[model samples]
Target: MKNFDIVTLTVNPSLDKSTSFRGLVPEQKIQCKNPRFDAGGGGINVSKAIARLGGESLCVFTSGGDTGKQLEALVQKEGIETHAIAVKNATRENLIALDLNTNSQYRFGFSGETLSEPEQQQILEAVSGLKTKYLVASGSLTQGMPPEFYQRIAAIAKASGIKFIADTSGEALQKTLETGVYLLKPNVGELAKLVGVEKIHADEADDAARTLIDKGQAEIVVVSLGPQGAVLVTKDITEFVPAPNVPKKSTVGAGDSMVGGMVWALSEGKPLQEVIRWGVACGSAATMNEGTQLFKADDARRLFEWLGRK
Candidate 1:
Protein backbone atom coordinates (compact mmCIF):
# COMPACT_ATOMS: atom_id res chain seq x y z
CA MET A 1 0.00 0.00 0.00
CA LYS A 2 1.05 3.62 -0.54
CA ASN A 3 1.70 6.16 2.22
CA PHE A 4 0.01 9.43 3.09
CA ASP A 5 1.44 12.74 4.26
CA ILE A 6 -1.78 14.49 5.18
CA VAL A 7 -4.02 13.68 8.13
CA THR A 8 -7.54 14.87 8.97
CA LEU A 9 -9.01 14.55 12.44
CA THR A 10 -12.66 14.39 13.29
CA VAL A 11 -14.02 14.70 16.80
CA ASN A 12 -17.50 13.59 15.82
CA PRO A 13 -18.03 11.21 12.88
CA SER A 14 -20.91 9.19 11.49
CA LEU A 15 -22.13 6.87 8.76
CA ASP A 16 -24.36 8.59 6.24
CA LYS A 17 -26.99 6.24 4.88
CA SER A 18 -29.22 7.36 2.05
CA THR A 19 -32.21 5.83 0.27
CA SER A 20 -33.99 7.03 -2.84
CA PHE A 21 -37.68 6.77 -3.66
CA ARG A 22 -39.72 8.04 -6.57
CA GLY A 23 -42.00 9.93 -4.29
CA LEU A 24 -41.79 11.26 -0.71
CA VAL A 25 -45.31 11.50 0.62
CA PRO A 26 -46.31 13.46 3.68
CA GLU A 27 -47.26 11.52 6.82
CA GLN A 28 -46.99 8.25 4.97
CA LYS A 29 -44.71 5.27 5.47
CA ILE A 30 -42.76 5.33 2.25
CA GLN A 31 -40.17 2.77 1.29
CA CYS A 32 -37.18 3.61 -0.87
CA LYS A 33 -34.79 1.63 -2.97
CA ASN A 34 -31.23 2.24 -4.17
CA PRO A 35 -30.03 2.84 -0.66
CA ARG A 36 -26.38 3.79 -0.09
CA PHE A 37 -24.08 4.26 2.87
CA ASP A 38 -20.83 6.23 3.20
CA ALA A 39 -18.40 7.46 5.78
CA GLY A 40 -19.13 11.02 6.79
CA GLY A 41 -18.31 14.07 8.96
CA GLY A 42 -16.45 17.16 7.82
CA GLY A 43 -12.95 15.75 8.20
CA ILE A 44 -13.94 12.37 6.84
CA ASN A 45 -15.55 14.08 3.87
CA VAL A 46 -12.37 16.05 3.32
CA SER A 47 -10.44 12.81 3.30
CA LYS A 48 -12.98 11.38 0.89
CA ALA A 49 -12.52 14.27 -1.52
CA ILE A 50 -8.75 13.95 -1.24
CA ALA A 51 -8.91 10.28 -2.20
CA ARG A 52 -11.09 11.06 -5.23
CA LEU A 53 -8.53 13.64 -6.33
CA GLY A 54 -5.85 10.92 -6.43
CA GLY A 55 -4.27 12.12 -3.21
CA GLU A 56 -3.66 10.28 0.05
CA SER A 57 -4.65 11.15 3.60
CA LEU A 58 -5.19 9.40 6.93
CA CYS A 59 -8.55 10.00 8.62
CA VAL A 60 -8.37 10.01 12.40
CA PHE A 61 -11.37 10.06 14.70
CA THR A 62 -13.18 8.23 17.49
CA SER A 63 -15.31 5.24 16.83
CA GLY A 64 -16.68 2.43 18.91
CA GLY A 65 -18.82 -0.71 18.99
CA ASP A 66 -20.40 -2.05 15.81
CA THR A 67 -20.93 1.28 14.19
CA GLY A 68 -17.25 2.13 14.50
CA LYS A 69 -16.23 -1.14 12.92
CA GLN A 70 -18.74 -0.59 10.15
CA LEU A 71 -17.49 2.92 9.57
CA GLU A 72 -13.91 1.65 9.36
CA ALA A 73 -14.82 -1.06 6.89
CA LEU A 74 -16.79 1.40 4.78
CA VAL A 75 -13.98 3.96 4.72
CA GLN A 76 -11.32 1.38 3.93
CA LYS A 77 -13.54 0.05 1.18
CA GLU A 78 -13.48 3.56 -0.24
CA GLY A 79 -9.64 3.42 -0.02
CA ILE A 80 -9.24 5.87 2.86
CA GLU A 81 -6.66 4.86 5.44
CA THR A 82 -7.74 5.56 8.99
CA HIS A 83 -6.42 5.77 12.55
CA ALA A 84 -9.22 5.75 15.06
CA ILE A 85 -9.65 5.59 18.81
CA ALA A 86 -12.28 3.19 20.00
CA VAL A 87 -14.70 4.39 22.65
CA LYS A 88 -17.60 2.90 24.64
CA ASN A 89 -20.73 4.13 22.92
CA ALA A 90 -21.82 3.27 19.41
CA THR A 91 -20.93 5.63 16.64
CA ARG A 92 -23.70 7.74 15.17
CA GLU A 93 -25.58 7.10 11.94
CA ASN A 94 -27.06 9.86 9.78
CA LEU A 95 -29.83 9.05 7.33
CA ILE A 96 -30.91 10.58 4.05
CA ALA A 97 -33.92 10.06 1.79
CA LEU A 98 -34.00 11.25 -1.79
CA ASP A 99 -37.08 11.79 -3.92
CA LEU A 100 -35.73 11.49 -7.44
CA ASN A 101 -38.96 12.46 -9.20
CA THR A 102 -39.07 15.68 -7.29
CA ASN A 103 -35.29 15.99 -7.38
CA SER A 104 -35.27 16.61 -3.65
CA GLN A 105 -33.38 15.09 -0.70
CA TYR A 106 -34.05 15.03 3.00
CA ARG A 107 -31.46 14.34 5.66
CA PHE A 108 -31.54 13.44 9.34
CA GLY A 109 -28.40 13.67 11.47
CA PHE A 110 -27.33 12.28 14.85
CA SER A 111 -24.40 13.08 17.08
CA GLY A 112 -21.89 10.36 17.82
CA GLU A 113 -21.45 9.01 21.29
CA THR A 114 -19.10 11.14 23.31
CA LEU A 115 -15.55 10.08 24.14
CA SER A 116 -14.14 9.78 27.60
CA GLU A 117 -11.26 11.88 28.87
CA PRO A 118 -8.77 9.08 28.37
CA GLU A 119 -10.07 8.45 24.90
CA GLN A 120 -9.75 12.12 24.10
CA GLN A 121 -6.23 12.14 25.55
CA GLN A 122 -5.24 9.13 23.52
CA ILE A 123 -6.42 10.86 20.34
CA LEU A 124 -4.47 13.92 21.34
CA GLU A 125 -1.37 11.81 21.81
CA ALA A 126 -1.92 10.28 18.39
CA VAL A 127 -2.27 13.76 16.96
CA SER A 128 0.89 14.84 18.72
CA GLY A 129 2.80 11.99 17.16
CA LEU A 130 1.37 12.24 13.66
CA LYS A 131 4.06 12.94 11.05
CA THR A 132 1.89 14.50 8.38
CA LYS A 133 2.80 17.86 6.80
CA TYR A 134 -0.80 19.05 6.89
CA LEU A 135 -3.10 18.38 9.81
CA VAL A 136 -6.64 19.15 8.78
CA ALA A 137 -8.78 19.44 11.94
CA SER A 138 -12.28 20.08 10.79
CA GLY A 139 -15.77 19.51 12.17
CA SER A 140 -17.78 19.73 15.37
CA LEU A 141 -16.13 19.61 18.74
CA THR A 142 -16.95 16.63 20.85
CA GLN A 143 -18.99 17.29 23.97
CA GLY A 144 -16.70 17.37 27.08
CA MET A 145 -13.70 18.70 25.22
CA PRO A 146 -12.12 21.84 26.66
CA PRO A 147 -12.69 25.10 24.87
CA GLU A 148 -8.93 25.43 24.35
CA PHE A 149 -8.48 22.19 22.44
CA TYR A 150 -8.33 23.98 19.11
CA GLN A 151 -5.92 26.49 20.53
CA ARG A 152 -3.77 23.71 21.87
CA ILE A 153 -3.90 21.86 18.57
CA ALA A 154 -2.88 25.01 16.77
CA ALA A 155 0.05 25.43 19.10
CA ILE A 156 1.05 21.85 18.50
CA ALA A 157 0.84 22.34 14.75
CA LYS A 158 2.98 25.44 14.98
CA ALA A 159 5.49 23.59 17.10
CA SER A 160 5.60 20.72 14.65
CA GLY A 161 5.72 22.99 11.61
CA ILE A 162 2.54 21.51 10.20
CA LYS A 163 -0.01 23.52 8.30
CA PHE A 164 -3.22 23.61 10.35
CA ILE A 165 -6.52 24.24 8.65
CA ALA A 166 -9.65 24.46 10.75
CA ASP A 167 -13.31 24.27 9.67
CA THR A 168 -15.68 24.45 12.58
CA SER A 169 -18.76 26.41 13.61
CA GLY A 170 -20.18 28.55 16.48
CA GLU A 171 -18.15 28.95 19.61
CA ALA A 172 -15.67 26.35 18.43
CA LEU A 173 -14.93 28.54 15.42
CA GLN A 174 -14.41 31.53 17.61
CA LYS A 175 -12.18 29.60 20.01
CA THR A 176 -10.17 28.10 17.16
CA LEU A 177 -9.65 31.49 15.60
CA GLU A 178 -8.27 32.78 18.87
CA THR A 179 -5.45 30.27 18.32
CA GLY A 180 -4.02 32.01 15.25
CA VAL A 181 -5.14 29.36 12.83
CA TYR A 182 -3.23 29.06 9.55
CA LEU A 183 -6.52 28.99 7.68
CA LEU A 184 -10.22 28.90 8.54
CA LYS A 185 -13.27 28.11 6.42
CA PRO A 186 -16.32 29.78 7.91
CA ASN A 187 -19.68 30.12 6.26
CA VAL A 188 -21.62 33.36 6.72
CA GLY A 189 -23.53 31.93 9.67
CA GLU A 190 -20.37 30.72 11.35
CA LEU A 191 -18.54 33.94 10.63
CA ALA A 192 -21.50 35.85 11.90
CA LYS A 193 -21.62 33.78 15.04
CA LEU A 194 -17.94 34.35 15.77
CA VAL A 195 -18.29 38.07 15.27
CA GLY A 196 -21.49 38.22 17.29
CA VAL A 197 -23.20 39.64 14.21
CA GLU A 198 -26.45 37.89 13.41
CA LYS A 199 -26.73 38.95 9.81
CA ILE A 200 -23.84 38.52 7.31
CA HIS A 201 -24.97 39.58 3.86
CA ALA A 202 -22.74 40.18 0.83
CA ASP A 203 -22.22 43.79 1.81
CA GLU A 204 -20.91 42.73 5.24
CA ALA A 205 -18.04 40.52 3.98
CA ASP A 206 -15.45 43.28 3.86
CA ASP A 207 -15.95 44.47 7.40
CA ALA A 208 -16.48 41.01 8.88
CA ALA A 209 -13.49 39.54 7.08
CA ARG A 210 -11.30 42.40 8.13
CA THR A 211 -12.47 42.24 11.73
CA LEU A 212 -11.44 38.58 12.08
CA ILE A 213 -7.98 39.31 10.65
CA ASP A 214 -7.53 42.49 12.60
CA LYS A 215 -8.31 40.65 15.82
CA GLY A 216 -5.23 38.48 15.19
CA GLN A 217 -7.48 35.46 15.30
CA ALA A 218 -7.12 33.96 11.82
CA GLU A 219 -4.47 34.50 9.19
CA ILE A 220 -6.69 33.55 6.27
CA VAL A 221 -10.46 33.34 6.27
CA VAL A 222 -12.65 31.87 3.56
CA VAL A 223 -16.14 33.23 4.10
CA SER A 224 -18.45 30.89 2.21
CA LEU A 225 -21.50 32.85 0.96
CA GLY A 226 -23.35 29.88 -0.46
CA PRO A 227 -24.75 30.46 -4.00
CA GLN A 228 -23.31 33.96 -4.20
CA GLY A 229 -19.79 32.48 -3.97
CA ALA A 230 -17.12 33.12 -1.29
CA VAL A 231 -14.83 35.80 0.06
CA LEU A 232 -11.19 35.10 0.91
CA VAL A 233 -9.46 37.30 3.45
CA THR A 234 -5.84 37.60 4.39
CA LYS A 235 -4.20 40.09 6.68
CA ASP A 236 -3.94 42.74 3.99
CA ILE A 237 -6.14 41.63 1.10
CA THR A 238 -9.45 39.97 0.35
CA GLU A 239 -10.40 38.10 -2.85
CA PHE A 240 -13.73 36.92 -4.15
CA VAL A 241 -14.32 33.60 -5.91
CA PRO A 242 -17.68 33.24 -7.58
CA ALA A 243 -19.49 29.92 -7.71
CA PRO A 244 -20.12 28.07 -10.95
CA ASN A 245 -23.69 27.68 -12.16
CA VAL A 246 -24.14 23.92 -12.04
CA PRO A 247 -27.21 21.74 -11.70
CA LYS A 248 -27.63 21.37 -7.97
CA LYS A 249 -27.23 18.01 -6.27
CA SER A 250 -27.66 18.29 -2.51
CA THR A 251 -25.23 20.91 -1.21
CA VAL A 252 -23.46 18.33 0.90
CA GLY A 253 -19.71 18.20 1.50
CA ALA A 254 -19.19 21.42 -0.43
CA GLY A 255 -17.26 23.07 2.36
CA ASP A 256 -15.25 19.95 3.10
CA SER A 257 -14.46 19.59 -0.60
CA MET A 258 -13.30 23.18 -0.68
CA VAL A 259 -10.97 22.57 2.27
CA GLY A 260 -9.67 19.41 0.64
CA GLY A 261 -8.94 21.22 -2.60
CA MET A 262 -7.38 24.16 -0.85
CA VAL A 263 -5.07 22.00 1.25
CA TRP A 264 -4.19 19.81 -1.73
CA ALA A 265 -3.32 22.77 -3.96
CA LEU A 266 -1.37 24.50 -1.23
CA SER A 267 0.53 21.32 -0.37
CA GLU A 268 1.74 21.18 -3.97
CA GLY A 269 3.17 24.69 -3.54
CA LYS A 270 0.50 26.34 -5.67
CA PRO A 271 0.01 30.04 -5.15
CA LEU A 272 -2.77 31.06 -2.78
CA GLN A 273 -4.73 32.59 -5.66
CA GLU A 274 -4.65 29.34 -7.60
CA VAL A 275 -5.40 27.43 -4.43
CA ILE A 276 -8.52 29.50 -3.87
CA ARG A 277 -9.58 28.77 -7.44
CA TRP A 278 -9.34 25.05 -6.89
CA GLY A 279 -11.13 25.35 -3.55
CA VAL A 280 -13.99 27.30 -5.09
CA ALA A 281 -14.11 24.83 -7.96
CA CYS A 282 -14.35 21.81 -5.70
CA GLY A 283 -17.03 23.42 -3.55
CA SER A 284 -19.07 24.31 -6.61
CA ALA A 285 -18.62 20.85 -8.05
CA ALA A 286 -19.77 19.21 -4.83
CA THR A 287 -23.08 21.01 -5.16
CA MET A 288 -23.55 19.03 -8.36
CA ASN A 289 -23.87 15.75 -6.50
CA GLU A 290 -26.32 14.32 -4.02
CA GLY A 291 -25.61 13.14 -0.47
CA THR A 292 -21.90 12.80 0.30
CA GLN A 293 -20.43 11.95 -3.09
CA LEU A 294 -18.36 15.05 -3.80
CA PHE A 295 -16.53 16.49 -6.82
CA LYS A 296 -13.48 15.10 -8.53
CA ALA A 297 -10.62 17.32 -9.67
CA ASP A 298 -11.29 17.07 -13.40
CA ASP A 299 -15.01 17.82 -13.17
CA ALA A 300 -14.31 20.65 -10.76
CA ARG A 301 -11.67 22.09 -13.11
CA ARG A 302 -14.07 22.10 -16.03
CA LEU A 303 -16.61 23.90 -13.87
CA PHE A 304 -13.88 26.27 -12.76
CA GLU A 305 -13.35 27.57 -16.27
CA TRP A 306 -17.07 27.95 -16.82
CA LEU A 307 -17.21 29.97 -13.62
CA GLY A 308 -14.85 32.56 -15.19
CA ARG A 309 -11.57 31.64 -13.60
CA LYS A 310 -8.84 34.10 -14.68
Candidate 2:
Protein backbone atom coordinates (compact mmCIF):
# COMPACT_ATOMS: atom_id res chain seq x y z
CA MET A 1 0.00 0.00 0.00
CA LYS A 2 1.93 2.99 -1.26
CA ASN A 3 1.15 6.25 0.53
CA PHE A 4 -0.57 9.00 -1.44
CA ASP A 5 -1.77 12.47 -0.59
CA ILE A 6 -4.95 12.08 -2.66
CA VAL A 7 -7.40 9.17 -2.31
CA THR A 8 -10.44 8.42 -4.48
CA LEU A 9 -13.34 6.15 -3.47
CA THR A 10 -15.57 4.37 -5.96
CA VAL A 11 -18.07 2.01 -4.34
CA ASN A 12 -19.78 1.20 -7.64
CA PRO A 13 -17.09 0.44 -10.19
CA SER A 14 -17.68 -0.70 -13.78
CA LEU A 15 -15.97 -2.17 -16.84
CA ASP A 16 -16.84 0.11 -19.75
CA LYS A 17 -17.13 -1.47 -23.19
CA SER A 18 -17.25 0.95 -26.12
CA THR A 19 -17.74 0.45 -29.84
CA SER A 20 -18.81 2.23 -33.03
CA PHE A 21 -21.47 1.43 -35.61
CA ARG A 22 -22.10 2.77 -39.08
CA GLY A 23 -25.83 3.10 -38.63
CA LEU A 24 -28.50 2.79 -35.94
CA VAL A 25 -31.55 0.97 -37.23
CA PRO A 26 -34.17 -1.01 -35.36
CA GLU A 27 -33.97 -4.81 -35.14
CA GLN A 28 -31.48 -5.33 -37.95
CA LYS A 29 -28.07 -6.89 -37.44
CA ILE A 30 -25.80 -3.89 -37.32
CA GLN A 31 -22.10 -4.36 -37.80
CA CYS A 32 -20.07 -2.96 -34.94
CA LYS A 33 -16.37 -2.31 -34.64
CA ASN A 34 -14.13 -4.04 -32.17
CA PRO A 35 -14.90 -3.01 -28.61
CA ARG A 36 -12.56 -1.04 -26.35
CA PHE A 37 -12.60 -1.81 -22.65
CA ASP A 38 -11.63 0.53 -19.81
CA ALA A 39 -11.96 0.63 -16.06
CA GLY A 40 -14.69 3.15 -15.22
CA GLY A 41 -16.60 4.70 -12.34
CA GLY A 42 -16.42 8.34 -11.42
CA GLY A 43 -13.55 7.99 -8.98
CA ILE A 44 -11.65 5.45 -11.05
CA ASN A 45 -11.87 7.61 -14.15
CA VAL A 46 -10.68 10.54 -12.07
CA SER A 47 -7.64 8.53 -11.05
CA LYS A 48 -7.00 7.63 -14.68
CA ALA A 49 -7.13 11.30 -15.61
CA ILE A 50 -4.66 12.14 -12.84
CA ALA A 51 -2.34 9.45 -14.08
CA ARG A 52 -2.50 11.00 -17.54
CA LEU A 53 -1.28 14.27 -16.00
CA GLY A 54 1.77 12.61 -14.40
CA GLY A 55 0.17 12.59 -10.96
CA GLU A 56 -0.47 9.75 -8.55
CA SER A 57 -3.39 8.93 -6.29
CA LEU A 58 -4.62 5.92 -4.37
CA CYS A 59 -7.80 4.54 -5.95
CA VAL A 60 -10.11 2.68 -3.58
CA PHE A 61 -12.99 0.73 -5.13
CA THR A 62 -15.21 -2.33 -4.67
CA SER A 63 -14.32 -5.51 -6.52
CA GLY A 64 -15.98 -8.93 -6.93
CA GLY A 65 -16.31 -11.79 -9.41
CA ASP A 66 -14.70 -11.86 -12.86
CA THR A 67 -15.92 -8.44 -13.91
CA GLY A 68 -14.37 -6.95 -10.79
CA LYS A 69 -11.09 -8.69 -11.54
CA GLN A 70 -11.11 -7.27 -15.05
CA LEU A 71 -11.84 -3.83 -13.69
CA GLU A 72 -8.96 -4.12 -11.23
CA ALA A 73 -6.60 -5.19 -14.02
CA LEU A 74 -7.69 -2.28 -16.17
CA VAL A 75 -7.10 0.22 -13.34
CA GLN A 76 -3.73 -1.31 -12.61
CA LYS A 77 -2.87 -1.03 -16.30
CA GLU A 78 -3.30 2.72 -15.91
CA GLY A 79 -0.55 2.63 -13.24
CA ILE A 80 -2.84 3.69 -10.42
CA GLU A 81 -2.38 2.28 -6.94
CA THR A 82 -5.60 0.53 -5.93
CA HIS A 83 -7.18 -0.90 -2.80
CA ALA A 84 -10.06 -3.16 -3.71
CA ILE A 85 -12.50 -4.51 -1.15
CA ALA A 86 -13.92 -7.96 -1.88
CA VAL A 87 -17.65 -8.37 -2.22
CA LYS A 88 -20.05 -11.22 -3.09
CA ASN A 89 -21.80 -9.61 -6.06
CA ALA A 90 -20.21 -9.01 -9.44
CA THR A 91 -19.38 -5.53 -10.65
CA ARG A 92 -21.42 -3.91 -13.44
CA GLU A 93 -20.48 -3.21 -17.07
CA ASN A 94 -21.58 -0.22 -19.20
CA LEU A 95 -21.91 0.15 -22.97
CA ILE A 96 -20.96 3.15 -25.13
CA ALA A 97 -21.75 2.95 -28.84
CA LEU A 98 -21.04 5.72 -31.32
CA ASP A 99 -23.17 6.18 -34.41
CA LEU A 100 -20.67 7.29 -37.03
CA ASN A 101 -23.32 8.54 -39.42
CA THR A 102 -24.94 10.89 -36.92
CA ASN A 103 -21.94 11.41 -34.68
CA SER A 104 -24.12 10.60 -31.71
CA GLN A 105 -22.95 8.59 -28.74
CA TYR A 106 -25.37 6.24 -27.03
CA ARG A 107 -24.44 5.28 -23.49
CA PHE A 108 -26.19 2.44 -21.71
CA GLY A 109 -25.38 2.15 -18.03
CA PHE A 110 -26.31 -0.71 -15.71
CA SER A 111 -26.95 -0.74 -11.99
CA GLY A 112 -24.22 -2.19 -9.81
CA GLU A 113 -24.86 -5.28 -7.74
CA THR A 114 -26.15 -4.66 -4.25
CA LEU A 115 -23.64 -4.86 -1.40
CA SER A 116 -24.52 -6.49 1.89
CA GLU A 117 -24.38 -4.56 5.15
CA PRO A 118 -21.05 -5.99 6.16
CA GLU A 119 -19.65 -5.26 2.73
CA GLN A 120 -20.79 -1.64 3.00
CA GLN A 121 -19.27 -1.44 6.48
CA GLN A 122 -16.02 -2.79 5.11
CA ILE A 123 -15.90 0.06 2.61
CA LEU A 124 -16.52 2.57 5.40
CA GLU A 125 -13.75 1.09 7.50
CA ALA A 126 -11.32 1.23 4.61
CA VAL A 127 -12.06 4.90 4.04
CA SER A 128 -11.81 5.65 7.75
CA GLY A 129 -8.38 4.08 7.94
CA LEU A 130 -6.95 6.19 5.13
CA LYS A 131 -4.35 8.85 5.97
CA THR A 132 -4.46 11.41 3.21
CA LYS A 133 -4.75 15.11 2.54
CA TYR A 134 -7.60 14.96 0.08
CA LEU A 135 -10.40 12.35 0.01
CA VAL A 136 -12.56 12.41 -3.10
CA ALA A 137 -15.86 10.51 -3.02
CA SER A 138 -17.38 10.47 -6.48
CA GLY A 139 -20.02 8.53 -8.47
CA SER A 140 -23.51 7.37 -7.60
CA LEU A 141 -24.76 5.42 -4.63
CA THR A 142 -25.68 1.86 -5.53
CA GLN A 143 -29.13 0.36 -4.77
CA GLY A 144 -28.13 -1.32 -1.52
CA MET A 145 -26.21 1.63 -0.14
CA PRO A 146 -27.93 4.25 1.95
CA PRO A 147 -28.18 7.86 0.79
CA GLU A 148 -26.10 8.86 3.79
CA PHE A 149 -23.17 6.71 2.72
CA TYR A 150 -21.30 9.67 1.21
CA GLN A 151 -22.20 11.75 4.21
CA ARG A 152 -20.57 9.14 6.41
CA ILE A 153 -17.38 9.44 4.37
CA ALA A 154 -17.58 13.20 4.60
CA ALA A 155 -17.77 12.94 8.37
CA ILE A 156 -14.71 10.75 8.43
CA ALA A 157 -12.75 13.14 6.22
CA LYS A 158 -13.74 16.02 8.43
CA ALA A 159 -12.77 14.25 11.64
CA SER A 160 -9.41 13.36 10.14
CA GLY A 161 -8.85 16.96 8.91
CA ILE A 162 -8.75 15.86 5.29
CA LYS A 163 -10.18 17.97 2.51
CA PHE A 164 -13.22 16.26 0.95
CA ILE A 165 -14.14 16.85 -2.70
CA ALA A 166 -17.43 15.29 -3.78
CA ASP A 167 -18.86 14.79 -7.27
CA THR A 168 -22.28 13.17 -7.19
CA SER A 169 -25.93 14.01 -7.71
CA GLY A 170 -29.47 13.48 -6.40
CA GLU A 171 -30.06 12.43 -2.81
CA ALA A 172 -26.58 11.12 -2.26
CA LEU A 173 -25.06 14.51 -3.14
CA GLN A 174 -27.73 16.32 -1.23
CA LYS A 175 -27.02 14.32 1.93
CA THR A 176 -23.28 14.77 1.62
CA LEU A 177 -23.75 18.53 1.57
CA GLU A 178 -25.38 18.23 4.98
CA THR A 179 -22.02 17.19 6.36
CA GLY A 180 -20.29 19.93 4.31
CA VAL A 181 -17.44 19.35 1.85
CA TYR A 182 -14.25 21.15 0.86
CA LEU A 183 -15.24 21.34 -2.80
CA LEU A 184 -18.09 20.32 -5.12
CA LYS A 185 -18.13 19.83 -8.89
CA PRO A 186 -21.68 19.78 -10.17
CA ASN A 187 -22.97 20.58 -13.64
CA VAL A 188 -25.27 23.57 -14.20
CA GLY A 189 -28.42 21.48 -14.03
CA GLU A 190 -27.33 19.86 -10.78
CA LEU A 191 -26.49 23.27 -9.35
CA ALA A 192 -29.96 24.48 -10.30
CA LYS A 193 -31.53 21.53 -8.53
CA LEU A 194 -29.47 22.14 -5.40
CA VAL A 195 -30.58 25.77 -5.32
CA GLY A 196 -34.26 24.74 -5.60
CA VAL A 197 -34.71 26.05 -9.10
CA GLU A 198 -36.06 24.40 -12.22
CA LYS A 199 -33.17 25.70 -14.28
CA ILE A 200 -30.42 28.30 -14.20
CA HIS A 201 -29.23 30.45 -17.03
CA ALA A 202 -25.50 30.90 -17.63
CA ASP A 203 -25.47 34.36 -16.07
CA GLU A 204 -26.94 32.97 -12.86
CA ALA A 205 -24.29 30.30 -12.29
CA ASP A 206 -22.09 32.34 -9.95
CA ASP A 207 -24.94 33.44 -7.73
CA ALA A 208 -26.40 29.96 -7.61
CA ALA A 209 -23.06 28.56 -6.52
CA ARG A 210 -22.81 31.34 -3.97
CA THR A 211 -26.07 30.14 -2.42
CA LEU A 212 -24.47 26.81 -1.55
CA ILE A 213 -21.24 28.38 -0.29
CA ASP A 214 -23.24 30.74 1.88
CA LYS A 215 -25.00 27.78 3.41
CA GLY A 216 -21.64 26.27 4.36
CA GLN A 217 -22.49 23.24 2.18
CA ALA A 218 -19.15 23.50 0.45
CA GLU A 219 -16.23 25.87 0.58
CA ILE A 220 -15.79 25.93 -3.18
CA VAL A 221 -18.41 25.18 -5.86
CA VAL A 222 -17.43 24.59 -9.46
CA VAL A 223 -20.33 24.78 -11.88
CA SER A 224 -19.54 23.04 -15.15
CA LEU A 225 -21.29 24.65 -18.14
CA GLY A 226 -20.41 22.10 -20.77
CA PRO A 227 -19.36 23.84 -24.02
CA GLN A 228 -19.61 27.28 -22.51
CA GLY A 229 -16.91 26.31 -19.98
CA ALA A 230 -16.85 26.25 -16.16
CA VAL A 231 -17.13 28.71 -13.28
CA LEU A 232 -15.43 28.49 -9.89
CA VAL A 233 -17.09 30.14 -6.89
CA THR A 234 -15.68 30.44 -3.43
CA LYS A 235 -16.77 32.57 -0.47
CA ASP A 236 -14.96 35.67 -1.75
CA ILE A 237 -13.84 34.79 -5.27
CA THR A 238 -15.55 33.87 -8.54
CA GLU A 239 -13.79 33.10 -11.81
CA PHE A 240 -14.94 31.67 -15.13
CA VAL A 241 -12.80 29.66 -17.54
CA PRO A 242 -14.17 29.29 -21.03
CA ALA A 243 -13.70 25.95 -22.77
CA PRO A 244 -11.21 25.90 -25.60
CA ASN A 245 -12.81 25.04 -28.94
CA VAL A 246 -11.73 21.63 -30.19
CA PRO A 247 -12.99 18.82 -32.37
CA LYS A 248 -15.43 16.74 -30.34
CA LYS A 249 -15.22 12.98 -30.20
CA SER A 250 -16.80 11.41 -27.11
CA THR A 251 -17.84 12.91 -23.77
CA VAL A 252 -17.86 9.70 -21.79
CA GLY A 253 -15.34 10.80 -19.17
CA ALA A 254 -15.10 14.58 -19.55
CA GLY A 255 -16.43 15.52 -16.13
CA ASP A 256 -14.23 13.05 -14.31
CA SER A 257 -11.26 14.34 -16.26
CA MET A 258 -12.05 17.85 -15.12
CA VAL A 259 -12.15 16.72 -11.49
CA GLY A 260 -8.90 14.86 -11.92
CA GLY A 261 -7.14 17.85 -13.43
CA MET A 262 -8.34 20.16 -10.69
CA VAL A 263 -7.42 17.72 -7.94
CA TRP A 264 -3.99 17.12 -9.41
CA ALA A 265 -3.40 20.85 -9.80
CA LEU A 266 -4.61 21.48 -6.25
CA SER A 267 -2.25 18.84 -4.91
CA GLU A 268 0.54 20.72 -6.70
CA GLY A 269 -0.50 23.94 -4.92
CA LYS A 270 -1.79 25.74 -8.01
CA PRO A 271 -3.94 28.82 -7.55
CA LEU A 272 -7.71 28.66 -7.86
CA GLN A 273 -7.67 30.36 -11.28
CA GLU A 274 -5.07 27.97 -12.64
CA VAL A 275 -6.99 25.10 -11.02
CA ILE A 276 -10.17 25.90 -12.98
CA ARG A 277 -8.15 26.40 -16.16
CA TRP A 278 -6.57 22.98 -15.75
CA GLY A 279 -10.02 21.51 -15.23
CA VAL A 280 -11.43 23.05 -18.39
CA ALA A 281 -8.33 22.18 -20.38
CA CYS A 282 -8.40 18.52 -19.36
CA GLY A 283 -12.14 18.28 -19.86
CA SER A 284 -11.91 19.83 -23.32
CA ALA A 285 -8.98 17.59 -24.19
CA ALA A 286 -10.92 14.51 -23.11
CA THR A 287 -13.66 15.31 -25.63
CA MET A 288 -11.12 15.02 -28.41
CA ASN A 289 -10.59 11.32 -27.76
CA GLU A 290 -13.02 8.49 -28.32
CA GLY A 291 -14.58 6.11 -25.81
CA THR A 292 -13.38 6.04 -22.20
CA GLN A 293 -9.90 7.31 -23.03
CA LEU A 294 -9.01 10.42 -21.04
CA PHE A 295 -6.82 13.34 -22.11
CA LYS A 296 -3.24 12.87 -23.24
CA ALA A 297 -0.54 14.60 -21.26
CA ASP A 298 0.68 16.61 -24.24
CA ASP A 299 -2.84 17.57 -25.21
CA ALA A 300 -3.69 18.74 -21.69
CA ARG A 301 -0.47 20.73 -21.44
CA ARG A 302 -1.08 22.36 -24.79
CA LEU A 303 -4.59 23.31 -23.83
CA PHE A 304 -3.49 24.62 -20.45
CA GLU A 305 -0.85 26.80 -22.08
CA TRP A 306 -3.38 28.06 -24.58
CA LEU A 307 -5.72 28.94 -21.76
CA GLY A 308 -2.95 30.76 -19.91
CA ARG A 309 -2.65 33.10 -22.88
CA LYS A 310 -6.26 34.17 -22.50
Clashes of each: 0, 0
| TM-score of predicted structure 1 | 0.92
Compose the digit string of candidate 2's lDDT tens values, residues 1-310.
7679999999998999999999899999989999999999999999998999999999999999999999999999999999999999999999999999999999999988899999999999998898999988889878868999999999999999999999999999999999999999999999999999999998899999999999999999999999999999999999999999999999989999999999999999999999999999999999999998988889999999999999
Worst 10 residues of 2 by lDDT: 136-145
lDDT agreement with native, every candidate: 0.81, 0.94
Residue-wise C-alpha lDDT for candidate 1, range 1-310, written one tens digit per residue: 3445788998788888877888777899887786678888888989888887778899998888888898888888878898888888888888887788988888888755667888878878888887778889888766767767777788788888887888877666677777777788888877787888778888688678788788887778888888888878887777888877788877778889999988887777877777777788999888887777778668887866765535
| TM-score of each predicted structure versus truth | 0.92, 0.99
Where's the lowest-lDDT run of ten residues in candidate 1? 301-310
- 297 Cα displacement, candidate 1 (Å): 3.4
Residue pairs in clash, model 2: none
Once fitted onto the true fold, the runs of candidate 2 whose alpha carbons sit more than 4 angstroms away are none
Best by lDDT: 2
